[model samples]
Target: MRWTWIDRFVRLEPGRRATAVKNLSWAEDYFADHFPGYPVMPAPLILEGLAQTGGILVGHVHQYRKNVILAKMTARFHAEAHPGQQITYTVELLDLNEAGARVRGTATVHDKLLAEADIMFAHVGPEQLPAELADPQFVFSGELAHLLRQAESVISASSSSPPSAVTS
Candidate 1:
């Protein structure tokens, strides 16, 4: 079964950055018997959310041809998330190339940082996402590719130097 986790995206972007929101609740199956009376959102799950957001950014930037995979992470949890709390995750790419992309992101609740990480993704074609996700009819991929191209255009324009040579 496709993990329902991917469906929880509240904010997703194809390029530049992506935001994801996860609402902690008692209804979650994982919380049911995790700790009985002292339940909390699992740390690993929080990291995955952040990773997913970053992965989406990388995949879109490369047009999904460079299969992006989570290569590594350096994550630190600063606070505990409780039931009913909403976690907002934002990821921004620091650098990107043919081989991989580096991103830094945070998950917060009420302006408090719950977790932060520097995540990396290695690029490969069709390997970044399963075949089911590679379909052209997929709305997310199409929308993301458009946005990513727009962002690239802006960056290219900003980086070009104005006419340098002077006419006689």
Candidate 2:
């Protein structure tokens, strides 16, 4: 089963950038095992959320025709995110090409930086992998597809509305 780390997309500018949000709560399963009294959001999960945001941005550039995989990432954490906080992941496309794409991402809560990451995503064609692993829909299927649709809906709704009616 695939778990979606991000809750929803707040903004998506295809080929340029993407912004997504994940709200942490004490009800999460990880919080139970992470710490009994002081539950902190796991660092890796935070990175995963950022990667998902960046990966969606990269895949959107190719119209989700290629499977975008996280190749490498370097991240630094400035503060711990707690259960009641909302994490906003903003990723900017640094570079893009046929082989791969690179993005710079930041996780923030209430305008304060919690973490930052530089992520690289590689695009792999069906022919480049084993048959079992080469499902064309592998990357953009299921939950991930749902997130993309939500992003498109937000983008479409915003574009059709007046500037004064739009609020971020």
Candidate 3:
């Protein structure tokens, strides 16, 4: 499915990090039977969201090349995210190399921490996985690429803006 989760939640923050937003709503498909009256976003899915966000960051750091897969994660869920909440997931790169990279991230609803994780990934060549899995060009092209490029452009312009001169 090309992991539409990334497009649905993630926003690249140019040279700093990537921030993803997940809007929980009663209309979500999973809410039908997910605790019926007391529903919450599943912890596993929240981890998946973190992984996707960090994966996108690693992918961009590699200039959209290489197949990157989550190798490890130490994640904790501190609070339940309920319907009508806007969860902001942010990932910051801790280190990067030819092999892969490490990222630290947190998911929050307003000031309440929903989850946090330290994610690690392995960067492999296109031959390391299924043709579909390894080809990022195919995965990110079309609409997703257009949106990401737009985000990237906006980040670039924002970064290039000069600091205002202070009154002497």
Candidate 4:
């Protein structure tokens, strides 16, 4: 099973920045073993979710040309996240090249910063691989469509106006 940590794309600003969310649920398998009775989300896993958000944004910048693999990270965790928290990861593009991309991001629960990191993504293999292999999103169009729908909803909702009260 291919695990997608982020649930929705709250914002995507092309080459500038992006924001995505992960809704932690009690039903997750890892929670049962993570801390026994006190289920706390692992720090590395939280960072992975953030990386996925950044990776997707970076892929958009490249139009899915090269593989975006995590090269390095300097992540600091400030708070523990429980099962019911919705973690929002906001990533800003620092730099990009054929070599890879550099992104800085922060994961937050509402207004509280849970974690922050500067992550680097690098191209994994030789220069000759086909785009299908180099950039993997194309291989799973059906699954990505569902994710895209969730993401698009967030983007559309942000630009939409609230319902007006009709006093008739």
Candidate 5:
């Protein structure tokens, strides 16, 4: 099964940055096995969210023609995130080239920092893979591809809507 770590993309800027969110819930399967009563979101999952956010940003740069794979990541967690909290992941492109791309990301809950990471994604070409695994759409197929469409819709909707009036 394909698991999407992010709920939705709030902002996406090709070759620049991306922002996405995930709402934690008690119903998540991991909570049942991860410490039972004191359900805390796994650190790896949090990192995955960041990577997904960054990965999408990198993929969008090439219009998803290239396979963007998470090659390396270094992260630090400052606090635990629990069910009912919302995690906001923001990633900025630090560097990008034919080889790959690097992103600096952060996860925050209600404006408080939860984790930060530096993630690297490798762009794999069809020729680099074995013939059996040389599907051009291998990485960005199905759910992951759907996410890009969803992000575009969100961006369109927000752009078309009138801005809300500010109140003192």
Candidate 6:
């Protein structure tokens, strides 16, 4: 299943970094059983949120030609987030190459850090992808479209390619 945990991009610097936000709501599906009386966002989901932010940064570098999958992560959680909290996830690219890239990120509420991680990704280009994902463009078309719309509306980074290049 393809699930994008981060809600929207607050900032996106191509090949450098990105910051996204996720406003937790009481209506979220998982809250019903996550703790019953003491509802809190799951740690794993938070990690995924951070990973998605880094993924978008890496994707911008590859020109949407690769599937930047999470290969490794060393994450630390310092606090729990309730439904009403809004998390700002910040991800910075540390290095990039034909093979993949490395990133460091943090999820924060207010000015305090709630969690952080150093994540590694494998940049599987179109030629290297499995048959199910051979069409790299379509594989990420939906996400790229949403992100592209967000990016164009916010920063007007005209140097980047438009999402419409990919057909439905």
In model 2, state the lDDT of residue 42: 87
Model 1 compared with the native: what TM-score? 0.69
TM-scores, each model vs. reference: 0.69, 0.89, 0.78, 0.79, 0.89, 0.85
Model 5: residues with Cα > 4 Å off, grouped in runs: 155-168
Indicate the residue-level lDDT of 104 in model 4.
96
Clashing pairs in model 4?
A: none
Model 6 Cα lDDT, one tens digit per residue, 13-70: 6766788999999998888889898899999999999998898788777566677888
lDDT of 2 by residue, 1-168 (tens): 668999999988666778999999899999998888889998999999999999998887767888999999999999999999999999988888788988999999989999999999999888788877646669888767788889886553333332331121
What lDDT score belongs to each candidate, Candidate 1 first? Answer: 0.68, 0.86, 0.70, 0.77, 0.86, 0.81
Segments in model 1 whose C-alpha atoms lie over 4 Å from true places: 2-14, 126-168
Clashes of each: 5, 0, 0, 0, 0, 0
Clashing pairs in 5: none
Instruction: Report model 2's TM-score to 2 decimal places.
Output: 0.89
What clash count does candidate 1 reach? 5
- The sequence of per-residue lDDT tens digits that candidate 5 reaches over residues 1-168 is 758999999887656678999999999999998887899999999999999999988887778898999999999999999999999999988888888989999999989999999998999998788888746668888777778898776543333332232100
On residues 1-168, what C-alpha lDDT tens digit does candidate 1 reach at each position? 323232244444444566667778888877877678888888988898788767766676645555577889999999988889888888877777777788999999979999999998876555445677646334335334544444334333332332222101
Q: What lDDT is reached at residue 153 by model 4?
A: 53
How close to the true structure is residue 150 of candidate 2, measured as C-alpha lDDT?
91
The RMSD of every model to the true structure, in order and in angstroms, is 7.9, 5.6, 6.4, 8.7, 7.0, 5.7
